[model samples]
Target: MMIYTPKAGNAPNDAFLFNVKERSDRLMNYFLMVYFVLGLIFALFYGTWLIAVLVGSLSLIAYYSTKLALPNSTMYQYVLSAVFGIFMAQFIYQMHGMFEMHFFAFIGGVLLITYQKWRLQIPMVIVVILHHALFSYLQNSGMDKIYFSQLYNFDVRTFVIHVTLASVLFYICGLWAYQLKKYNELHLSQTLQMAELQKESLLLLQREQYNEERSTILESIGDAFFAVDKDWVVTYWNQMAEKILSKPKSQMLNSNFWDNFDNSTNSISYQKYKKAVETNQSVHFQDYYEPLDNWYDVSAYPSEKGLSVYFKDITERKRTELLLIESEKKYSDLFQLSPLPKWVFDVETLRFLDVNTAAIEHYGYTKEEFMGMTIRDIRPVEEVPKLEADLAKQLNKDELTKRSNFWHKKKNGELIEVDVQSRDLVYKSKKARLIIANDITEKQRYIKAIEEQNDRLREISWIQSHIVRAPLARILGLVPLIENPAESLDEKEKMLEYMLQSARDLDDVIKNITEKTTITQNFV
Candidate 1:
């Protein structure tokens, strides 16, 4: 911050005094020059070369002295006034007491009053009195040639009257000078006071403007704000605070805080406020308010004068948090109580994160053992590379679920085929997968057995359809020939023998069919 210091010349009454001194010095110099000229002219007329030189020298000295002494010397003006008085006296004496020249004495005395220094007039008055007394005595005491004035019979009465009149004029001039000096001093003092007051007023205006801007910023903020004095009276309540509280500032300011809010003494917000004030520290918390059916995030700051509070309505955020918690609970229940053998494993490390009861029982591993093992531990060594490739592909896809068949090893070292259905998920803030394993070992065995039985049954059906028909057709042809009436004895004997051979072939075909059926049954 910059500090303001009034200039030296700007000090009270000094400017006026300094200006007067400058003007007086210039005026006195001019008067001295004129007096010197007049004195020299008079001396020349009277043929007094020495007096002319003396007057010229005195004039030069007085002018230079006043010019140099001004501003620094207070007595310079009075000294100049005395010098002018002496000049007048010398001029009158040189002119043999010309009364007109005596009048110059009065003029010089009156002119010195312009300096506003009554003391200067005193020196000029003294010079005039002494000049009058001495010159008049000389003229009256056998020095009549030295005329003091136009009235040559220079009596004591005339001298007294002249001196008295001069004294009265000097007195009046001195009084006026004194009063003028006093007036100047008073005016300068008042001016200085007014200047000081103006400076103070300007400072006050700046302070007020600063405060107004601060208040504007506070009012424009998004958060609710209020302040209370030590007496618990509301001192400041901003627009946001008004909206949050559903009350206007006009109704809140200057009112007791507790009275207006009607909060219970045991309320969390009330307790927080009390704690902040008692400890002279800042307090922050979130709490639900029953009156407004809302949640608020509040902060209170305490100072010597009072406490300031800032708060925000967080009811919507609170409700969202509650809903999320409920959703998480439901998900946890589903994962834990599932009938399928379900487990979760970290995607990056492939370490088991969690396993359901079904997963533990189906895998034949304790929960603790499962937690300590990775997904690769449950897969056959030959299938690990396939599992890795599948996982690598899964990493590139955001698919919810993936299905694959793999050989899995149980805790008893038994290898079984499993159909694994897995989905991506985040568990405990880490990328992971949830898996449900369907054991297909028994079902696969049953399916293989049924396939073998179907193959055997198909072979038996082909045999019965082609081989049995060939044998039966031969037997039928031979028996018909043997039963015919037109046949001779040799032909009948040959036909009967052929019929017996055909019947034997049919019996052999029947035996083959029975053996195939027996084999088909054994396969089933």
Candidate 2:
């Protein structure tokens, strides 16, 4: 395998310190210019050509000393530049005391303490301190270089004081550098550890995001989903499962599945799930009712460690089944006890599935013996040829219902007139027909009886209105002829009037009877 590396110029983090580097370079350049100006000022202050030459030479060295481009140079390069600049300043001050070199050395030592080694910076500090003390002693000692023998004193105390002060200054510089180095090392280690912790934290956040996304998808599905351990404790419960079972996941999950629950029904689903786990086999269950309102089809499959269960509500399907059963029961009872004959037949096969009690009686067959028989069996042989096409038409249509008059032959070969009403229906998962038949063998006799009663009432009404009333009318018309033929003819007139009143009463009775007969005919 080969590796690819980004070119340095285009690498993004490679320019991380570019602005800092630029600023650092500009500041260093400014410092160089300041060094040159300071050297020029010191040379001017010397007020002599040779001294000015010496000062200018030192100034040039300080200005150009750090102008090197080394990519891998350590911070020690900065320390070295500061040392050289300080030495140049020392030379300038030596040539002319217009500026204090001792104070400049102090500033250089303070800067060197930031980067230089403790042991190394100590010796430099001692040299600067010794130079300071020697200068002071020389100033106070004498006006000229008088001979030591003539001086009568070596000034041992003065020498001792100068050495002691230098030693103390070196010791302080060593201690300062050592403490700074230790502090830098400790700070660097802590910073690296903090960066590593941040990386680990970011990885954990990504893992959590992935898990949350996965869980959201699972909960959005409509099926109730759950998982359990080998011991049958609930491990996971999805949102649908919570909604269907009316149980909160916080209270139910991780608990024993058979524990006391808030379910409306103590669901056998939980029990069946446990059984599937114990048997280590998958189980499929159908048409199980949780309550009057809840029905489910469920399956549990064994997993390596436990079981996974899935189920969906089938309440609508179960409700439809119950409605069909109730409808069938209502019609079955009516057919069995009804006075009129009735029969149920399979439409496709045209075979009888069942018959009511009256149908069996009228057809002269037992209930069990009549089942599985065909409609043609009880029909007249002459009618069978024409019946095939009619039955076919009935079966072919989506819904076929009609009333017809047909001839039926009894088991003993007696012919009967039957009024039949039939409709297509489904029976026991098969297409069938429901038939109700009324035997009309005595229908004409009943009609004749009603007609006779109606005719007699009409005749009586005619006799009362015409025969009886006409005679009464004739007697009233002859009332004037018989009136005064005898003494007291008024008495005969009263007797004729009573006969006319009797005739009127008979006519009223006839009219009432005729009206009642019409109503009876309508009811029949």
Tens-digit per-residue lDDT, 192-267, candidate 2 = 5787799889889988997798678668877888887887688889988888877789977889776634352346
Can you tell me which runs of candidate 2 are displaced by over 4 Å?
1-221, 249-255, 260-267, 284-295, 314-324, 395-400, 442-524
Worst lDDT 10-window in candidate 1:
1-10
> In every candidate, how many clashes are there?
0, 0
Query: What does the lDDT read for residue 40 in candidate 2?
Result: 53
